[model samples]
Target: MEITILKSVIIDDCTTHRTVLKRLIENHPDLVLEGSYRNGIEAKNNGCEKNADLIFLDVEMPFIDGFDLLESFKKRPQVIMVSGKPDHALRAFEYDVTDYLLKPVSPKRFDMAIKKVQRNTGTMTGQSEDEHIFVRSNFRKVRVDYGDIKWVEALGDYVKLITEKKNILVLTSMKAFEQKLPENRFLRIHKSYIINLDRIENFTSTEVQVCGKQMPLSRKRKSRLLDALGAG
Candidate 1:
């Protein structure tokens, strides 16, 4: 059988830890490092295309944390946690990570994780396509569908999820809300705004009109947002 080619992204803060993880991933003949990021914000801010197969995510970073990074993408990639701290394993599971690797990871263990990743590719197919997601709101699990999500706006320590009929300002980070959305349907038009593509009526270079509400579209995101809407 031909060795399956894998594209990977590495995000971590510590230089030593990133170097170790890079060496480990490089040792595997089947895994290829697509990019390495020193921070979670840089990784997510860069955006994910359709082909990113896996992400070696760090649990902690400067502006945005690992879990937040995972949550920011509408299309969730198969993420293997790489952290110096072991206690973050439970938290990793909470974000539904594919695997957990503690710092100073051995090359052998890294190869093993790649093997597991290779074998599980079938199950990983379209894993993020499922639309319904449960978010903890008011100490209860609330079910929200992709269609119900109007837009996501950032707050100090939370994100405001405005639905068609109601608005929920959850006590969570923007990164957390980012992870819950479907990539094909949601577009982060600005650092402070992620709009549901399906809900938009029209848009301009500077703003998007969603449900009769005009929201500014960041200059950087204008093209991608248009492409996502099939307008470009």
Candidate 2:
């Protein structure tokens, strides 16, 4: 399979945080660092969104806050808001951001956020052909039958693909898996989970039982899940 490298830009006022984020982006195999700006003003003036698919933006910046900078963009890129203050999370969601991370972001959390971006981009691009997908497991390529997957769980930098007789760990994102799987057979019921619809044994408003394992269901996704099952 060919790799899709996403162009990314960093807009933050703090030098230390910016440097750390730059390193993280550079280290990711799927991301390409395009530009780094010290403030939102500079980022906006340079038309960062025009050339980038992803943006790591700071909520609080020196002149023209992150929100204002977003407003200025005619076409917005996928944004991951990095802020010291958690209070901006609610407002950030209003813009339908990919994810919000508090300052001093951990590697695990950052990886999760990037997964969200990858998934969102996949939806925009289009879904893959159903049947099977090739995944790397145990340092070797493995072909997973879509029908055999019971559910998928998100790990920090990888996803656990659970089938009836085995659990395969792949160095990939949940969003990436969600995109590859046939939508008719799978549904994302939570941020960290995507279950094979045929494997569901029972479900409630708050949880789902699949392969004798219960997984939490997000309230926001409950209605969508029901609709997918033709129960809504």
Candidate 3:
């Protein structure tokens, strides 16, 4: 399975810690460093927090402390608290954070924290338009809203995601990519195609049209597709 590419931001008052965390995130394949802020105020004012799917947050900072910063978010994303002290671990849990990373974070521990984030982002499929998944394309994380996707096409070792905004070619097998979608919303109509049920304008016995393109609908899977579309 492909790791979900997280849109990540760092908030730390210490220049040294911020630099270190930034390097680690940049080096990891699953993380895409969106921005690095010296303090909570800088992070807030820049509007980086709103767009981020994950935050590598420092528990102690100027202007607003880490706990206070968590409170400020109208909608908080997955937060991995990074602190120098072990004392705040219990208090941080009350906020329902993804994980807590101690300062001078080791690479091994960092990866473990990431695994939690992956489980949350990967397995859970949301049924609303507000929900989204990040796909790796052109060596960057591209966020695609559930409502925007029209279909997914199998392309050898990769799958081409056809969306309303743009087409993205992700380095993952079709069977693997199919698992990321909500089964009730998406149906595999053929060996080569999985179409968004909401986007279907019309279809025939042999083919279905999506995003103005005719894609082959294998006979074997057509009954399953029909059942999915007919279901509530």
Candidate 4:
């Protein structure tokens, strides 16, 4: 699977803060820094929001604020509001912003925000509720049906899709794969395992049986997994 890199833009009035954000955006493998603007007016005038997938916007800017700029966009992308004020959090969420990060962002918090973006917008370019997905295997693309998949296992940097017939290995992150799958049908029981809810024949507190294979179940996700399976 070829993961689609998110085209991101950074808009901030402060030069120092913008520099810090630019570094963070460039460091992320999945994000491609498209443009960096000093203010929302400059970003709007240059049409930076035209083809951007994500935006790191500062709420307080000279002349035009972040919220005003967001409202001006006819077609808005996913926004992660970076501001010093905690009061803007509630209002930011009202606009359906992906996340609101306080000033001087940590690497860990930035990663969490990126995960939220991945969950909201999948690696796939377009949005779809289709039953099938195409994955690369053996240097070729193979279409896999959602119903046919029994489970998914994380193997090093890749993930193995286990079906009734064969297990196909694809180069992709588990989080990225999880975003592609329907939550109702698939449940992540452990960090490395996502199982098909319908395929589970039996389960205990510590493990689940799918196609005669026992999969380890995490204590934290045990209740959620059971709830998903309707066995709680």
What is the C-alpha lDDT profile of model 1 across 35-71, one tens digit per residue? Answer: 8888976776677423578898888789988887787
The global C-alpha lDDT for each of the candidates, from Candidate 1 onward, is 0.72, 0.81, 0.79, 0.82
Give each model's clash number: 4, 0, 0, 0
Which candidate ranks first by lDDT, i.e. highest?
A: 4
**Model 2 Cα shift for residue 203 (angstroms):** 23
lDDT of 2: 0.81
- The predicted structure with the larger TM-score, 1 or 2, is 2
For model 1, what is the alpha-carbon lDDT of residue 199?
A: 59
Candidate 4 deviation (Cα RMSD) = 12.7
lDDT of candidate 1 vs native? 0.72
Give the lDDT of residue 79 in candidate 4. 88
What does candidate 3's lDDT look like per residue over 107-176, in tens digits? Answer: 8768756755765577332244536888899999999987678899888988999887878999998888
TM-score of 1: 0.50
Candidate number that wins on lDDT, 1 or 2:
2
Residue-wise C-alpha lDDT for candidate 2, range 1-232, written one tens digit per residue: 4568899999999999999999899888889999999998788788999989999999999888999998888989998888887667556655667677887877776776676676657632334565578898888998887767889999999999998679999988888878888665689999999998656666666888787899999999987775554333
Each candidate structure's TM-score, on Cα atoms with residue i matched to residue i, is 0.50, 0.56, 0.52, 0.55
User: Candidate 4 lDDT (Cα, whole model)?
Assistant: 0.82
Which is better, 3 or 4, measured by TM-score?
Answer: 4
